[model samples]
Target: MISFHFEPSSLSSTEKRDRLLKLSVVSSPILGAYFFSTGDLSSPFACPLREFTGIPCPGCGLTRSLMAIAQGHLSQSLSYHILGVFLFLFLVLALLYFSAELITGHPLKISLSGPLQRHKRLLFPLLGLFLLSYHLARLALLWQSDQLLPAILNSPLGQYF
Candidate 1:
């Protein structure tokens, strides 16, 4: 049996800010290369899971999606993987928040410090539903369209997907 714990107290604003900055630094070059690389830009690196299983992972199209966005193809990016857009939005917000924290010396904090803390009751269920729906949609698309997967994987714009 496995047990899981959720403790809001463990969420540290400083750590969040630092992590955001680190991720931005790490993603920059990959994003740049993804944008600049010519066609035939499949990764030299192989996915270990795919190698062992011969099945694509749920995350298979995400890199190509990012590459598409880096290359300024928003429609193709979203088509490759919807979550890539969410990730880009989250990254941009995190970068902005981190930048503000660095400049102001006060990291942004989700102040569940008052009655808002109780709002977790509503927030959790809503978030869960959203994630469930999103994944279901992706799975449906994957099942319905074999071409979709390979199209994303092989697209010249797919270097980022």
Candidate 2:
């Protein structure tokens, strides 16, 4: 069996948290650019799971969705992939939180940790179901819409997709 394990470092909690927060801030712009870049949008990168087994991956339209959101088309972005919208919002919030922590030397603390940890058994399956359903709906919408193809193709990033 192959297994992975993570051992907490000896670094002070504050130091570790600060380092993580700083990393998040530094990577935000790069992530945003990658999300919005036209160059990567047109790449012919095939989904590994899809290629190996001829099944569409759950993340197929994510890139297009990100591109659409980056271009300021919220409705079209959601139609492309709901995950993209969620990701965009999450990233934005995370960036803001990290920035605030960095500037103020205080971290945002979530109060639901105890309940969340206790409910992991249920939460994991629910998360999986949500993701699967969301992706399938996105794929269906993509198939039904012809407008999305040309719109994506016409964009500067379309050439790279």
Go through the candidates in order and give each one's C-alpha lDDT: 0.61, 0.62
Candidate 2: where are CA atoms >4 Å away? 1-22, 25-45, 112-124, 136-161
lDDT by residue (tens digit), candidate 2, 1-161: 22222333344578658757676775664366465565545423556654444335788666677777666778977776677787777677677656655555554454445666678689769979999887777556655776445545655455556
Q: What are the clashing pairs of model 1?
A: 63-160, 63-161, 64-160, 64-161, 65-161, 67-160
Across 1-161, the per-residue lDDT of candidate 1 in tens digits comes to 22223333443677666766675785674566476545643543555545544345566666676677777778987877777777777666666655655555544464454555666588779867876686667766665878455645664445554
Scored by TM-score, the top model is 2
Candidate 2 colliding pairs, count: 6
- Give TM-scores for every candidate, taking all chains together and pairing residue i with residue i: 0.55, 0.57
